[model samples]
Target: MSDRQTPLLGPDVFARRQERLRQELITRKLDLFIAAPSTNFQYFAGYNPGRSERLIAVFVPAKGGSVIVCPSFEVERLTRNAAVQDIRGWEEQEDPWRLVRTALGEMKPQHGRAELALEHTFDYASYLRLAGVGGDWHIQTAQPVSERLRIIKYPEEIALIRQAIAITEASIAATFAALQVGMTEREVAGRLSEEMRSRGAPGGGLVQFGPSSALPHGGPGGPKLAREMVVLIDAGSPVEGYASDITRTIWWGDAPSEEFKRVFNTVHDAQTAAMQFGKPFTTRCQEMDRTARKVIADAGYGLFFTHRLGHGMGMDGHEVPYLVEGNETRLEPGMVFTVEPGIYQIGKFGVRIEDDCLMTETGLEVLSHRVAKL
Candidate 1:
């Protein structure tokens, strides 16, 4: 989205997010909570950050008003953007513990009442430091509330995701069409990234090609694009902070050997099967992962199907609701993630098919167009 259009959440919008969080907190018996970063803070405080370290502590009392503890500099912004009743600040010189102590002083929660739900954002070291203000206020850290909330998409969130997916879909299409023998894998990735940015996508990406595809995350480098090798271009676009993740493995040159074609078709069919069955409320996320692997396995490439079938992608590229084995997280409607099935034989070559899927009210929808071209 453009700079003019902000994250769809406004002050009152944040209040709704907090209402849900407060209910969760109350259920968990948390009297006060300190959350941080773009999504969580934005969810509760309606505040977004251009950079990190802008700490925001949102304290929702079980019985009374909620307060946002912030650095002195951000108090004004928080006041304007937040639906909170009180704005607490600490001077840059003074230890933030002054405000932290004040907020904690009031919340005589049962035991873990005054706690912090730190997402991937909080460093363990920082949590250790907060241990300094130790007292009856059991200042503890837990997984962020917002991360769990963002796993499900709201209407506006789905819109941004659709735009991100469109841009990504177009970018991949262009990349496939632009492919030609003798161009480097780096070149193909560059073409796609520039196109995404030009089409209003956040530029730059994680892409790899050739035998390097064996490395799921081998980003751009000076590797030559060759014939008879699969070009694995995994890229995406972002809109209003929502991101889409997609990958396409386009093989160039003449038709492959009997073994390679059989494997490629099997993977293609595996990707299709995985998508056909992905839907809300399925315990089959791991089953979906296994579906792809089983196909590759029956064809004798099971070991090569590295990495999970997908991961949650919304405000952040990777979020919750991961589609992997050993994970029993139920897939739900409004959930968005990738269904990327691949076979990577290290050092020789790799082939992967990735696409974005949205678990809709009806069933699974391919948000990112899953088309192979090269």
Candidate 2:
């Protein structure tokens, strides 16, 4: 039983989240599970890593709420912000693995054996260390179960995501208004981040621009925005631990070439098509991605549309239920993510329009407005 804490959420919400995890474990036939700071710690535990070295391991049993083995210093922080019931602490001087071993013992099954599970991004060293001490355990690490649990969003999570989307949209609009042909991409991006910071949004995203856009993640600054080049901005804001990602290709000049207009409209249309039928209980993301990719491929920039349509956006910037080929996760009402379809011509220009979208009972609602083309 959880104690009554002012910062804690109601018991029902926490139990509901825990119940979902139990179902995922049962479906995967697991006895015990562990996850590190990346997705497992971020979404499941509702905690972000301040440093890469601060590893967090979450343990989920076949039944009951999970136990977290985190550094002793984080106990107060966890109790204040998260809703976990079983909190295990570890000291830096002592090997953290011992604490984990104890927690796993508490949830021990009848056979003196436990099945281990992990998120795809779990640290290899951490796994080795834990497994070294973990004898008689069938360690199962893969993508299937983690995918099911994280692919969709819940209502409370969606609310924070919507807030993230709102802040990101304001930053994009501000970025354009603050833009000048002579100003470098770095300068523009700095201004964009400042706008969000001023508004109390802590976690910001990339402001990659100009030739930078050519590199996919070419990053910010150094080059000036030329007449024909597009200023591609990929930015986000974190609200209540949920992150919203939005990318828009902004043109620097008023002289929009026919090709430019055509590409922009195509990308825009692709985004619309992918999000068209997004709703509760409809989880067909492969079809949604195909719809977006086909538009770019048919228009003759198939190779240029290099990346997948989008990824799941939630507690972390990226999560499960990825929007790409070979993925079968169904879209659900509470699930929110981006629909970005791009076509980049090497040494030329690339166009990608991204907008945060939520699957609702009625269909889809664009969380942020489409960035206006100049």
- Taking the candidates one at a time, how many backbone clashes does each contain? 0, 6
Task: Give the alpha carbon lDDT tens digit for every residue of 194-277 in model 1.
Answer: 898889867556556567878878866736766676677777787867788877776666876565566668778888888887
> Cα lDDT of all candidates, in order?
0.71, 0.72
The true-versus-predicted C-alpha distance at residue 282 of model 2, in Å, is 5.9
Off by over 4 Å in 2: 1-12, 49-56, 71-74, 90-93, 208-211, 226-229, 277-283, 371-374
Across 1-374, the per-residue lDDT of candidate 2 in tens digits comes to 12212222254665666677777777867877676655455555555444347656677787766887778888776666555767777787877788877776777777745777766677778778777877777787746776667666777777777778888888878878777667777777788888888877764556555556766677665467656557788888776566888887867776767877888887887777677746566658888889888877787767788888987787667776678999887887667778888878767677888888877778888888876543
Give the poorly placed runs of model 1, Cα more than 4 Å off: 1-5, 50-56, 60-66, 76-86, 110-120, 180-182, 254-260, 372-374
Q: Which ten residues in a row have the lowest lDDT in candidate 2?
A: 1-10
- Residue-level error in angstroms, candidate 2, position 174: 1.1
- In terms of lDDT, the poorest run of 10 residues in model 1 is 1-10
TM accuracy, model 1: 0.86
What count of clashes does model 1 give? 0
